[model samples]
Target chain A: MARIVVDPVTRIEGHLRIEATVEDGVITDAYSAGTMVRGFEKILKGRDPRDAWAFTERACGVCTTVHALASVRTVEDALGISVPRNAELIRNLMFCTQMVQDHVVHFYHLHALDWVDVVSCLSADPKETSRIAKSISPWPKTSPAYFAAVQNRLKTFVESGQLGIFANGYWGHPAYKLPAEVNLLAVAHYLEALEWQKELVKIHAIFGGKNPHPNYLVGGVPCSINTEEVGTINTERLNHVGSLINEAITFVEQVYIPDLLAVAPFYLDWASVGGGLPNYLCYGDLPTKSYAEIDSFKFPRGAILDRNLAEVHEVNGRDAEEIKEYVAHSWYRYERGDEAGLHPWDGETEFDYTGPKPPYEQLDVEGKYSWLKTPRWKDHPMEVGPLSRMLVAYASGHTDVQELVNETLGRLDAPVTALFSTLGRTAARGLETKLVVHWMKEFYDALIANVKAGQTRTFNDEKWDPSTWPATAEGVGMTEAPRGALAHWIRISGGKIDNYQLVVPTTWNGSPRDAKGRRSAFEASLIGTPVANIDQPLEILRTIHSFDPCIACAVHLYDPDGKHVHQVNVC
Target chain B: MTRESGTTIIGIGNLLMGDEGVGVHVIRHLERTAPPPPGTEYLDGGTGGLHLLEPLQARTRTVIIDATADGRPPGTVRRLTPRFSSDYPATLTAHDIGLKDLLDAAYILGDPPDVTLFAVSITLPSKLGTELSDPIAAVVPGMAERVLNELD
Candidate 1:
């Protein structure tokens, strides 16, 4: 038996350390640890509830608006405010736009290199790549000359001896299964996706005044519709948004989905691996009506227990017993004991670093190890994210979700059982992006119709002032972030935040084990995975990146040196 | 919208992490004290990643201000024209995507803008706070002036 530790996993949003104990070429046990500590909950204390969105929005650089959305919704939920229909439609548009754009960026930029071999693309015939690209989709950029140009660029980049970001990748690993022609084609789309994403984010800039950290109001959206005005969302801006939506739909359908389908067949065995937990959770989002109408959510809210698609248990964010967080294997001290669980409303953010100091070799996995607190749904560790959302929607009889899942499964010639693996998680992201791009059109048309009907109200100022107040109130805001289930709980006292807790997606999937010694998604998924070479564990990256781990959102602060501390030890 | 040409001065850092936000602070200072010349724009790129590519490509030149940990004094500032990713300082605050990676992506896509990087040395932050340290805060005006000079 040998223990392989990959510290500071590259190509992820933040620092994550994975330790796997391999026995006879297969992982017998795995431990996932989030090294950074997040202080957002501590920062929000004693501040006005209305201004919390601005601060919490900086939690993660990638999923900028998800935190802000949850923050504003929590404040509004506490204040008992109902925004206008137009504001709802505009928020929906932004939400769906974020989903579509984030998924595309994840698949192409962050997750693609794991499966693609840039060095092998140098050996590919551009004409063969062009032929494969043309046969896959009518994307119009499929000529042999285009493929050749992309290949030339890659050759120059590699031969320059300055691999930069690609420097540390296991390029010629045996785990890479794609053909050279397909690899070249995927490389071309990778560059194209980068350019496409920059243009796609203009929708956020148009409505929310900026991207990265778009402006969000407490009651409703920050932007007001004025078809004739120059500063607000006007006729010209509306047209720009319309065209961008159309372009997004085309890119996802023509480029993203096609690439996903093309690459999935080469690695069908992955469909049987990385199916971690038996339970799944999703706090559904994309409300067709107001947020109160749970039945109207495009992504229905529920939980799947024991991998039973036949039933999806009802999920409640406000119920204290429904969801609770424990710190048995985390660097936190609950006022009640480490073994006891506390709901978010009664959550605490005290830090107790009992693990090894920095620059240390191994972590005391038996003791407290990770920065992420273990969150259990009704005392059961549940997997969250795209797979959970898709499974819930499928079990709920959501027509569009069912159709997409069945169609993709049919194309791959796989069974419904395959929906529980890493491939399913990745394919679900692309399929949902397909559904969301079309929803963007629906939202845009709805906003236009409301404008034409002379209903231009975007903010409700009734609860804007703190004078109209209650003594103390507690509220929970739940939404489906691009990663998975996200909820922010707030307790307002004397118009100030008394306590605030955020249970993000990564905390559910990438967290350590609970008091029962059962593993969460990240650790459990790697238990049975095979490692071809202990020195270069490319297979581990394939399964982990499938979750699109966002540790910056999961764990917060960094090493005091601000330097990336990397280490790979084989013992 | 018509594409604006000329220089774009972009400041990249996390505003929540004390001196780590020197770039954003310098951008704000320049915006207030010295206005841009004609088509030059000021952008507060919070912990910049690939998103900086489009803005960089839209302009003919770009001036980036960021905090670096290069074993120098806290307030020391230096400027360089980095042609490749390896030229960037080893440590740029905690960001999902590093500046070097973003520059590399721009180079691969072709037509990378002429970039001038201004790096300020600082001790990496251990806690979260919005206010910059005294030493780093004292140099903000000087960094802004240098960026303005580069623009001119």
Candidate 2:
């Protein structure tokens, strides 16, 4: 009875629970529990469409803009309206700003602890560690001080704020492979990265009117740009951000990349570890000066992966829709896959736990002991996230991302195939942030030009009508959250929400026993995690964070604020 | 001695320890509320260990909200400051010495805040869930306001 569990896998955005069953020291079963239940969808019923953007973004502070953009797009799709190009640019910028911070934080605070092994400092020659720390990136405010002072600051942070998370740490263990000096520099830069990430978040607040969840209107941004006054990116600050990006790039190249290469050889075992479901999904916008005949940004639209590698196909929100909510073995109802998933406008929820499951069509779905719904693409569980989107974009040559990736790969010494793994996935996320930031500047310029030209209308005042929504219209909207692909489905009938469903990023990465009662990605990855001790599931946590598991966008099913249940009003 | 020049509400305890950190959570909410008690400072001095001496050693008085491991059903309210030093440290986890040391420092300093301790009893000292078990969470509202009521 080999068992391993990281009760609360720290890092990432929200709350999560992971458990794995092992036989002969190898995990045979894995289950990911999205423990927190926030009733956003049920609460969004009968709400105004104008409010959905505001409310849905609050589901998760880190990816609010991503959520908001998706929500607004869904309504736009519903109404057949196009947001002005400039407005699109500005919204893209805000979302991009968020990505910058998210990537920086994830790389340093979250994943760095896993790779660098914080406790390894005990073995580090303080002189060499200090030399490496002082050389990498200096913290402006605290620089000029000796490396010993920096180390002391790290100690305080570890002891107090972080609590002895590094205590009894297994640094010299067989699993640890990175050089002591590289780890030392990474740890120091990890602290500097924290400061840099926080400043970038303030940029979101400056534009979106506060962070953790900004206030962006549907038509455009709620706040207009005033570069002369408020939009003042002082020369120093501007240069600082660019410099930080460069510094960050250097760190990723000099440290993270080399270290990943060193460690991969030791763990050549984990390359094939994960529930092998090759279906990938992506439905986010990109900025391409050259619009195709169909009017998409730079990238072509379609769901692509190794399965659909050669033949690209266009996919509307409708073609990529089919979800089933099974509460039989879960905390919530048992529903069939083809039953047309319910909407927030008409959904069912009960917190009582009764283990009952109904068999499915293809995969024999049974036993729903989770709050997560089974979301299958063409009736098969599909994986979604940065890796999926990147793979789709690269496999299909998404013009903008492809160009940037090719240019960067030409500079790296490693093979381009390495970009497909954990290191590439993480680095690509940062590159995507750059793509987003560039888009944001263009967005701001357009909005400002329009506003100064006597255009004060950043929002369209929609007198939402609750009675107009189809009594029974089943719809699902998918967007790229910072962690990966996020989706929301709703079915309404008789002027009330009947069923609402969401398949968050974690659900894709850390999925449970699916239709066939087999393992999902998170479970599959755990097979070779080599648990030294079940009490401390560090390896499992490392692999999980690498995927950037986000629980869900919470309970608010509405894309925006006003469309919440108490206020189901659409423009 | 009854009601000094200024009073501050400080919640101390582990947030993961159920109702133990209820005081801090409540204080955070209290701080976010407009028109707080005049000159009343609310601090979520999370187990600051030896760092407690600084905050407690100031102002007129301080209220320490914590889950005392005393033998009582969860949410049992016991009020004590440095006035009951001998029996106090034993009342909470050794991890809580951070709060006690600060209060002790404040008492040692002539400028101690008029202190009121709101000690909530708990069966489990450390666990997940911000919720207090049963009748305690139900009784917490009344139990929480008792200190404010006493001040009034």
Candidate 3:
């Protein structure tokens, strides 16, 4: 018998623990166990559909927009309505800020430590670091003083902070092979990115409510803008957002991206690990509301499907059926492996954990490998998010999105087929950033024009009559969150929540064995990845963390008290 | 001690760890509400770090509002003027960076606040919730007013 313990898996949000069985120098099985539980969906049981926006943002701080969007879309689905274009733009702007913030924070603060050494910075030549920080041209707030300020901030943060992000960094790791200059440059930008992320969130607060968790409603946003007469974006507030975006893009293009490719060669073996999942799925993205529909809310609804790498289909949310949560090798008890499909609205929360049992496929079921119930798309796996969006947009011939992809692939010197792999998924994040940037600038003008036309109403004040809403309606609402695909299904009997089922992207990726005992996306993504050291598996984390696991989905921990039936002395 | 002089007032507590900073959050609300009863400094002496000890010791009277992990319903508010004997611990290191270190440091410096009053809000500092629970998050205005009336 052997013990497997992996705690605080580097490069993921919050914390994680994935234990696996290693036999004869090869790992046979593993479990993705989240150490925290955020009962947001459980708490959301009886609340009014409109209030979902205010509450669901608690799912995850990093991807609050997706939560807000999912909540809004769910209500929209229930009401059978769409938002206006101006409303969509405002929402898009809110989503853009989160994306930029999430990417910057992840690359610099969270994951950067895995690759860059903070302790190594003490040996750096400040003058050289200063020079590197200012090398980029046409900078917004770059000067000797600004660079010095950045250095000072990092100094205070590292010195005062308890958790050493600098500990076990790339300075001495065999995996860390980036240049000293690149390391120094990244450290400087890391400090700058923290300050930069806060500024970006101001747009969220100004448009929604406050940072971390914003409050935008269904039908549309609760906030609107008017600054066309001044011919400027309320500069005092939104300027920092625009400035941060400009600074971040430059840093990514000049420093970060280049440094990644340079250091990536050192970790080339990652390409093989967690790399062979070909199935992908996305629920499409938020629909852009039109000008004339300012008072009304309308959104795009599409179901996405893909296999191999080329062919993709965009289906309506209605066409998406056969959704089921199976708990075969799971710790929890369920009706059966092949049970009737239930929308999130009608999800059964009778959590009954019969102590781990032997898996029908593998005996590890006795301690059931994980707590996550497998979510299958029509008896198969489906990938979602940036990959899904990219596939769907290309298939639909969204000319601008396609053009952006071609340009990116041309510059990357990689084929469009790269868009389908893990690397492609990561690259597609950047592409979506560009797509949103283009839309952001365009939306600014549209917002201005719409305001000039006296369109202040973003939400429909008159709501659907309770009598009008179907008593036993089952509806699924889907939207592309910052992390990827997010959806919520509702089953209404006489109106109180009968069952609520949510298939977050993280759930799809981190799921355990279903009634059929299938490996989840994250598990499947992990199969091919070469695991060198069982103790320190950075490659495995990088691949999984790339999806940015939203652990708040269905994480549970229980006390170690249970009745003992029998004990056998084998010693 | 503050009754002897009406010259200065101080507000102190942590501002992070969500509700643990309720003291600072509440005092800031005080500053925002009515004018800080003249010569008042609404300082968010976060976690009451060492830097706050000397400054607070120099104040004539100081009001501290903080999240106290006493057994009570979340947001149950209490005001304590230091006593010789009580069930509660004399010092709290509830936060990683706590107020006890700052106040104790102030005592060590031999210049602790003359009339130091602590408004403890009984609440769970951990689990993330947007709204404040029952009494503590609810009693900010009243707490501030009580401090203001004492200062006046």
Candidate 4:
């Protein structure tokens, strides 16, 4: 068996190393290793539970606010504090903004490179590109002159011998199938999207005070709405935010959704590739009414076992019996044994590096192979992320979700089973963006109506002082990040965090084998993938990118003392 | 369209990784102590991959402070004015593709900004901790001063 490894996978956040064993041009087995070991849980020990959000937000650069949200909720859960109505609405807005921003960025910047061949755009006619773009969507920027300018700029950059970030991409790979005109249109929109994303982040900047690590308080939002107060969230600022949301919605409706539909038809065959674990998990998020009401979540939560969309088993993120992280094949020592599964509340973040040293040919797969622990729901290895959330919602009989999923599939003329593959995973993100935009508008309208009604209280300071504390308390803060089910478990004694554990989204999707040696979504998905060329593992990248694996959030900081911590050599 | 006249100083790094957070540390220092030059904009470009391109493109001159693991001694600081995307150093910590691809996108849009990167060299820490190493932490003021001098 020949081994193909993509070390430090490019274009995604953080460092990841994927090694697969190919037999007769097909991947027979795969191992994913999160090369770093971030012991945030260990560091979180003995700290103020109130300060956990700040530290946990640092766990990821892309999804910082999700951690912040989960951290605050964890504290709130421990204190049994319920979020006030306005704060819930505002928090939902923040969550929606992150989802939209992240999904758009993922499509255009991170994952689009996998499908669209940028180099081929050089031969595309600007006029033809403009025509194709206009035919697909009414994006007003579709003038021939604009296309010509974009083409000229690209031509000059190519001739200048500096592709930069585009430098190392597999530009002219055979897997790319988009027509030259379509490719050119995609490239043009890609540039436009860069500016579009800047405007979107302004919403986050307004609500949370900044993007990439917004200021989040434990009990409520940091910003208070005061129309008369200067420099606060007044009418003009809220209007500006509303306008930005409209702009984002317009782009999603016109540019993003159409682009997905236009390009998806060409990649229809990808439906058969990268079908990993059929089991799915989602912790529902975007509460419409209140935090106490789980049924009101815009995206419903449940677990789908063995692709049985017929029945979605209930998944309680807090229940130790339901959600457990297995460390059998991961590089960690469990308190009971290496092969034991532990709930996050009883989780341990101790370090144990047993993999073969770096620059080695392959991981010792039989032994501990990865830093990512296998997180299982109901003892089943599950896939988590857009696909899981989409499938769970689809199975739960949510009418809008069902209509969107069925309608999108019907347009593509794809089977419902197509939802199990890489293209489905990518398309799920687009559909969910539409759903999120709808919910965002709803929440925005609700926020405004609440203001119009003159009920302006955003924070509940009743549980603000930790000094009025329980001697011991433990609680789970679970939410559906843009990724899948994310949970933060915290135990407090005398107001200080006694133990903190996190089961982030990536840890679920990018997990290693469990005690039974069942492959994770990452591993199982690669098992049957056909490799055209070992050197160019474009198929692998496409599948993994669909999941948007954020290894920085999965694994923590690597041990400097470990000889192979940061020196994993790619072959 | 006439371009906006100003320098946008972007501090890019993963602040959780000890010394890798030097860039943000420098920016925070400047925000607290030094008054920025006229028409200067400051941004905390935390490992924010593609989101950074728009800000970089809008400015005429952009100064980025980032930590580098380019085999340099700990606490070493190097300043570079990259004319082309290829002019950037090979190995930047964490969000390399984000910044590199950003420049490429800017180049494709034409009139790529003049980018100056303040790369601080230091060892990456073993475990997840927020505290920066002594040597790297000590150079924060110097890095801030150098970034401020670039404002004019």
- Which candidate, 1 or 3, has the higher DockQ? 1
Per-model TM-score, in order, reads: 0.97, 0.68, 0.72, 0.95
lDDT per residue as tens, model 1, A11-44: 7777788998988899999999998776668878
Span of 10 residues, lowest total lDDT, candidate 2 chain B: B89-98
Instruction: Name the 10 consecutive residues with the lowest summed lDDT in model 2 chain A.
Output: A560-569
Best candidate (score: TM-score) = 1
CAPRI verdict on model 3? incorrect
Which stretches of candidate 3 lie above 4 Å from their native place? A1-4, A21-28, A124-163, A167-171, A224-269, A289-307, A335-341, A355-367, A403-412, A415-422, A464-473, A492-498, A556-571, B1-152
TM-score, predicted candidate 1 vs. hidden true structure: 0.97
Q: What is the TM-score of chain B alone in each candidate?
A: 0.92, 0.76, 0.71, 0.90
DockQ of each: 0.47, 0.06, 0.07, 0.45
Ranking by DockQ: 1, 4, 3, 2
lDDT of 4 by residue, A131-203 (tens): 8988988889998899888888888877878776565578888989998889989888888887788778777
Worst 10 residues of 1 chain A by lDDT: A559-568
lDDT of 3 by residue, A375-467 (tens): 666676666666666666765557777887787667656666666555666666656665665556555556656766876566665554556
lDDT of 2 by residue, A26-106 (tens): 556566765444445544567555466665664553566777776665554444345555456556556566665666667
Pairs that collide, model 4: A37-A556, A37-A557, A38-A556, A38-A557, A560-B126
Arranged by TM-score, best first: 1, 4, 3, 2
Model 2: per-residue Cα lDDT over B56-92, one tens digit each: 5445667777666566766667777555243353433
- Worst 10 contiguous positions by lDDT, candidate 4 chain B: B89-98
